[model samples]
Target: MTDSLDPVVAKFVDALNSGDRQAFYALLTDDATMSDDGNDRDLRQWTESEVFGSDGRMDVESVSDGGRSLVANYTNSRWGSMRTAWRFTVSGDRISRFETGQA
Candidate 1:
């Protein structure tokens, strides 16, 4: 995984790896939106169901657009894993929107 990434994004990556829900949620807007596989989901519910449930690690393969977007090879306990693209839209210091899918 690449180390040279935006700090906020880097913290996000770390939060995911560590399954730190409080830290992860803190980086997001109160009504942050996340879409995966083209389906919009409730962020808290999605995180509880898909993210926190799996012990996951995101091997960020590369970053672009000043670390606002990235491609990663993700590994997890629940569903094996996949190469995915993650895009974040940040407003001020918190992420307002996020989208993820097969890369």
Candidate 2:
């Protein structure tokens, strides 16, 4: 059976590939939290900086799942290849909580 998270992950990948910060941020909640191997920062702040920064190119390699959460494989211009997991807590059509980490 097809994974329920496939479409959401696909949309995120598409946004990342396109370097569309607005679209990318739109996928996240206002209070979304993202934790990377490098630093602990809020998703909105990190994304905003990345969107405007000089070396913020993100190439999404693949997206997978671990039962409850989705994992995204990516290569950033500055960070190299890293696997990031996004655990989604959905509320209506939007995400109430988004926690990410290096997998």
Give the count of colliding residue pairs in each prediction. 0, 0
RMSD to native for every prediction?
A: 1.3, 4.0
List ranges where model 2 is wrong by over 4 Å. Answer: 1-6, 37-40, 49-68
Runs in model 1 lying further than 4 Å from the true structure: none
RMSD of 2: 4.0
Q: Tell me how far the alpha carbon of residue 15 in candidate 1 is from the true structure, in angstroms, after superposition.
A: 0.7
lDDT tens readout by residue for model 1, 5-61: 767788888898899999999999888999988899988887777778877789898
What's each prediction's TM-score?
Answer: 0.91, 0.61
TM-score result, candidate 2: 0.61
